[model samples]
Target: MFPQSICAVSMEKTSDQVFQIIALIVLVITSQSQNSCTAKTFTNLTTDESSLLRLKAEITLDPDLTITRNWSSRSSVCSWIGVTCSTRHHRITALNISNMGIYGSIPPQLGNLSFLASLDLSSNYFSGTLPRELSSLRRLKYISLWSNGMKGEIPSWLSLLPKLEYLSLRNNTFIGSIPISISNLTNLYHLDFSNNSLQGKIPQELVGMQRLQHLSIQYNYLSGSIPPALFNISTLRVLAFSVNMLSGRIPNDLCANLPSIERLHLRGNRLSGQIPSNLSRCSQLELLSLRSNSFSGQIPAAVGDLRALQFLDLSDNHLSVYFPTGTLPLSIFDISSLQVLSLQRTNLYGNIPREVGNLTMLISLDLGYNNFTGMKTKGYVIRAFV
Candidate 1:
């Protein structure tokens, strides 16, 4: 061609232009790839598939629930308020819709989320039987449907969940017997069916649940003899069977072997027989209630040995006995943790112990209604005691 120098200069310029074009193409491709990944990671959710969308729609119509519309399905669920997500992704793991005043039956479609662990639908106006479809969520661990107007028997399908640990169906209008299938929930730790219309014998198979720690079936229509197995479970720390129609002799060894017991309530039943002297073995006993039963016996002095005891109620029974005179055990007076002591309506005719003032933490002391007629004089004692 023309001149070697000019050709060389033009070649250099063309090379530079080609390099710039290739660099621009790479930049555009990289930007598009980043945007595509983001779009895929947080796919836009339609109103039909979004539980949050439906919740928001309902909350919008309610004057009481001032929910914000800022909630989006595209955002990480963990970042959303009142939602807990698993570590794997932004899938909702726990939904606490308590006291939301959202009036509607729980949508059966909620079973679509397999990662859900806890569902709290308490203190609302939700009506209708719990959907059987909820049993599809195999990962569910906790379920609370208390303080609602729900009816129907406890769903047997729910007992099939492998991971269910805590269940509360208290304060509902549910009727029928406590399903025997409840024994299948071996992993359950806390089971509360209180304040319902559930009636039937305490299933003996429930004793097989080794993990149960708290069992509250109070204020129900349950009848029959108190299952002996109920007293033998060592894992039980809180046992509330109050306001039921259970009867039988008070097991002498109820808390004798259970070293982990902290609270025991057997009030408002037809339980009879002597107070177990061996109950002092419940070294960890803090709150013990034996009120309003037909128990007729002498109060055991070993009761004063409960060093960890804080609240004791032996009222409304035919207990004809003294405080088992002698100096009250150091655990009773020196513990300084006793708060409530109600011995009213018992047959105690001894002088009121002046050492009762040693309970600085005593908040409520009801010693009236007993045969004792002595009036202890001290303004601090009455002021310190409720």
Candidate 2:
């Protein structure tokens, strides 16, 4: 009953309106889908999150534990379990869970954390290969995953983290050679790969880590001469390369250049040659161990100048040296410090200086397997405390 023109105009209007409404519905669905994806990714990070949190909650009562209450109200993860976060939005900066006795594999989802500074999961029972995805944590600074049962080769991709400073993967089952790319970690300060199944020469590339302060690669299957480049690290303070298959003379200038060195352990190896007298140049030296080696020489008298020395072990070798002269520096007698000393199996025939009695601080003194008697016996009384 209506005119054709009127009907046509109404139909056109209706079609345009329907198109607009459909476009609006599509836009809404897209926005919601994106938001849901983000939520699901974060919410279901681990299907076992409840168990993880319940385990960590016990940390609040431990004498060794402390946590910020402010984050406790956030989501379980956003909450402060092992987390350290930024001041503004509380993004995690560190996640130290050392000695927690937490069992199971490390969650690869941890790689999603972009702001983490440190991740310490030491002394746990974690097993399986270390997740290589960890390389995605570009902001990571320190990582300690020692004392576990983790297997497989060390993740070579970790060298990509620009801010990494400290890395310890000691006392694990990791096998294979140290990655040459480790040299790329220029900002590294402390590195320990000790007590693993790592074999082959210490990477010469590691010599490039100039900022490195402490390095320990002991108790592995590492063979070959100690890298001469190691001695060149000017900032090095503590160096432990013991209990390996390492042979050959320790780099000559090793201790000569490390003026700041406080402790040096080169024991339990096939290392040969006289103990470097130049080692006395380590004015800050406190501990020195050269046991179980093939060293044959006189104990350097310059060693007495190491007034800061607290512990010294040259036992289980063929060293021929007499005690330094004088009332063993009064510093050595101070009961407040200087506790242990061992010179066992050294071929020495001398009188025990009476000054040995002055070392009241000595707790364990080993002079067995030697040839000291007479005057040495008197000195032995004062110093036998070690």
Candidate 3:
């Protein structure tokens, strides 16, 4: 019986050896298959070719076959559909393949493209966080990845790109607070991060980005009062912070630093206090939206002074709460260039001045749920809800 036990142990050892031998055989076959693929597909691939091929391999879907069809081992990398190589160095400089409906995870291997200047992967189905390896790119200037499914925090490492000018990551699923480190991008001209799930206060450090022309962070969970320092950037043309959890009154010196400001959107917030009359200083002001806020006090008459104002919305606010008070600013009706005016549910009480008829360009006027006594006019077919 003891000899039989020894024989059973020997059989178990034999079975283990057989399993190990099978595993080794499988490993050898896999290694050989990989070697065969390399020998057949890659003829001493260049660094750029290697990185691009890795990217192509990572892609899950290519609806138009743009990348899958054009990125060929036989073809020169310079002639690739989305690639633009430098004239002297023959290195990739620009890669733009937007609106193609491609889906993939941006592989970290792409960071090897040291000379990449512009990258536009917008309107694609790309998912996953931007790889930290991207910080290695020094020459990167323009990056637009809007309308993608990218998630996770906006990496602070992005500030390392010294020459980065335009960056738009709008309409993504990005979460977490915006990294204050973004202020380091001094050369950034346009920065849009709208329609993200970003939380926390709008960074006061943004004042350091002196070259910023267009800054939009709308449709986020951003809280706290906007930094007054933001108003100091005279280069700002568009400042949109709508549909956020932001509170506190806007700075009285709002337009003082915004000399070139054309569009200002701050709707759907918890902001209270009077509308700043200093807004009239914005000579280039075209669109002003402050609806669905807690703002009170009289609608600023100074708003009428904005001759270039095309659209003005001050609706769903606590403006003119006191009855028999809050005269609908007569000057507002004097703006001939105004195309749309909305002051719905503002408790504003007054005789709609006859000057409203003078708003020849006005097409849409919404004064619903207000206290205006009368809207007497002639020769005007405006869409109004007085």
Top TM-score model: 3
Q: By lDDT, highest first, what's the ranking?
A: 3, 1, 2
Is candidate 2 or 3 superior in lDDT?
3
Residues 227-301, candidate 2, lDDT per residue (tens digit)? 887888889888998898899887655666788888888888898988776666888888888888888877665
The TM-score obtained by model 2 is 0.76
Error of 2 at 173 (Å): 1.1
lDDT for each candidate structure? 0.76, 0.74, 0.87
Q: Which model, 1 or 2, shows the larger TM-score?
A: 1
Candidate of highest lDDT: 3
- lDDT of each residue in 226-277, candidate 3, tens digit only: 9988999989999999999999999877888788999999999999989998
Candidate 1 backbone overlaps, count: 1
Work out how many backbone clashes candidate 3 has.
0
Error of 3 at 329 (Å): 1.9
- lDDT tens digits, residue span 1-386, model 1: 66999999999999999999999999999999999987544422232237566555544233364345445666654666567776665477787868866566766656665677898988877778887867877989999988987899988897879899999999999999988899999999999999999888888888988888999998887788877777777898988888888887867877765788898888888888888878779989998888888888777767877889898887778877555452223345565778888777665566666678799988888776555544443212222211
Stretches of candidate 2 above 4 Å error? 1-76, 321-337, 374-386
